[model samples]
Target: MSIIAVVGDCTTTTALALAAGWPSGHDAVILEADRTGGSLAAWLGTPASPSLSTIVANSPALGNSPSTAWSAVDAMVRHAPSGTRFIAAPVRSRAASRALSEAGGTLFPLLAQLYEPTIIADIGSYAVADAPSVLFSLASSIVVCHRQDAASAGAATVRLERLAELVQFLATFGVPLTVALIGDRPFGPDEVGQFLTADGQAEIVMHSLPVDDLTAAVFAGRTGVSERRLARLPLIREASALARQVAPAETDRAPDSSRIDQLGSSR
Candidate 1:
């Protein structure tokens, strides 16, 4: 029903894992649209075949029927150990990236028409005319994740300014741009929102996820602990809150947050 695109300096994988954990009955898939290369498959230990490259190559044929396109997408999809269905980014296929840039106008519209409920795309960072930029325009909401330190905030400020320019009427185009602050920073969510509004001239919504290195390690697949290990962490809590806001209909019937501990312990 909606597509939430997560980008900027934060850990995209962590966001995807949290979103996947949401109790949305409707299927949720993470589509990695990194412009340079795909690292999601390597991080999750999934093969990179049947990835964005394959999807782009098959775009012509996929346009014929919605069923056919969905089928094609399904073929490239992989289920992460955490139970999230994903299509990894293409590996070193500059050609594929170029193709995505050229035909994204046609490709993403079909993807939106075919997929329902939610599609969370991991767009590493904003690059002008990149593959993710095309999808950015079509997304229902954009979540820009950045750390709180001075350097990061400064970069984020510049990026947000550029993003506002890229998507005119971003505040009123039915596409809400949200900033998700990750890690410790001098400014709180409110202050950061105010700053973005003042400096970038973009009315922004903001949310923050506390810095938890261990929990982040688990989400990135660098740590061997089960994802349930993060059940009590604030990172997960904030993620659940954001997920609920973006896709409440999906989690409306879901159990309370405490169920996370139960689910974790059960396995």
Candidate 2:
């Protein structure tokens, strides 16, 4: 399995879109590991039980093996009406923080060992001080999402530098970093790339998703919108393309030994 962590200033919709638009025949599970709390339970109408909090509570019982830990995680997985699997996080920020703090040390390493399903972790904002750095060390790829507006771009410039520093420190050089631009406002892909490159993020790859408020609203839990209709929207279409571009190849699934060793030694 591959772990793709989606981090951003505000990327809930981007994460949801990627999971919803994942390529056919490859199972993708969205893990709500956001330390700031989560919205998937409410948006997808799933129960709060069998959540990140639940997983954290049960982690001590998980055997040392990755497969065993994965089995326990699988037991807590919930599905949306659209059939996408996800593990929810607590709605309360304090509870979410505590769960992540308690479970992160053991949870991320176990997740790194799994080799079956693709786990797309919605890691909330990388800008937060309490952001889970361990997940970044283990992810196969990291997608950073931001709006195309000036304010969002400005924030992303700063956060991307911080992310670059973290990745360098973790020695996760083999992991791919992608910048997904949400909406085409005053800035397009070229402009976004230029500014980011000027800010020393030239290594990051860029992708864009169109503004589709109607479809995005449905993802945010608006009732009466059909999934079939959403599939044809620009947002979903771009998300599918983005997924195809970022999904790790089968040959690349195994973690790089040197990188892992470096990460372990540094920790």
Candidate 3:
């Protein structure tokens, strides 16, 4: 159904939490599209092959249709012990970056075709110059995750400004952009909003995820928390609520002509 790109400073863990907490009746897959690198294979103990690199290597052989693209991607999907399905990126930074660069023009467009399972792409730490712009252009929604601290907020502001510029260039003003604040701190959503909007960036929706290190550790494959217990954690509960809010309903699906045309031209 929908492709939600999660980006910002240190968003891999936050993105994982969102994917794991997706509401019931909806099937979601985490696509580790981090340009820098990915740690899911090592973190979740999943296999290293049949990854993004595999998809990139095999892209030319696949048809341009959505069904064909979905099939190529589905074959590489792997499941973690926690029951989350994900497509891992290469572990090494150079390999990962190279794969993305080689496939940047096509990988996300192929991903855009699928409409069955919702995709939550963990696009860690968006860079204005080198980051793939097509990913943001085609995304149904974008969530910028950051901590409450001053440093993280400052970094998020910079990314948001870059995103504002990209959105303007692509003319994708309809796409929803959200700022998700991680953990508790002295400042709240209002203060965070003020900080983000002070620079006159695009309008952004605000959200928060609780601090639950134990549950996060479980997600990292560092703990033995049971599924039932994990679901009850504050972090999971809030993430589920957030997922419900951001993910579009099945009936609401409709092709945005401008975005589709933009994708064609970008290619």
lDDT value, residue 138 of candidate 2: 79
Residue-level lDDT for 184 in candidate 2: 69
Clash statistics: count for each candidate: 2, 2, 0
**Candidate 1: minimum summed lDDT over ten consecutive residues — where?**
258-267
Which ranges of candidate 1 are over 4 A from the true structure?
93-96, 115-117, 127-132, 150-174, 199-201, 248-267
Q: Best lDDT goes to which candidate?
A: 2
Model-by-model lDDT, in order? 0.64, 0.71, 0.69
TM-score of each: 0.80, 0.83, 0.81
Candidate 3 backbone collisions, by pair:
none
Quality of model 2 by C-alpha lDDT: 0.71
Expressed as tens digits, the lDDT of each residue in 1-267 for candidate 1 is 366777766546555645645654556677777676777777666676777777777777775565667776677678765555777777675854775575466666766765464678777766445433667667887777766565676775675466545433445445777777775565677766665676555667777877777656555666545436667667777777777666635346452444345333323
Instruction: Please give the RMSD to the true structure for each candidate, in Å.
Output: 3.9, 9.0, 8.7
lDDT (tens digit, per residue) of candidate 3 on 155-208: 656644564554333334467878787755656778767766665646778888
What shift in Å separates residue 142 of candidate 1 from its native position after superposition?
0.9
Candidate 2 lDDT over 1-267, as tens digits, reads 688988764577877777766655566788887877888888876777777888888887788998888888888889666566788889988998888777678876877887778888888876534544667777888887776455675665664467545434333445777878776665677876665666453467889888788767777767665445555668777887787777767533322223212212222
Cα error of candidate 2 at position 102, Å: 2.2
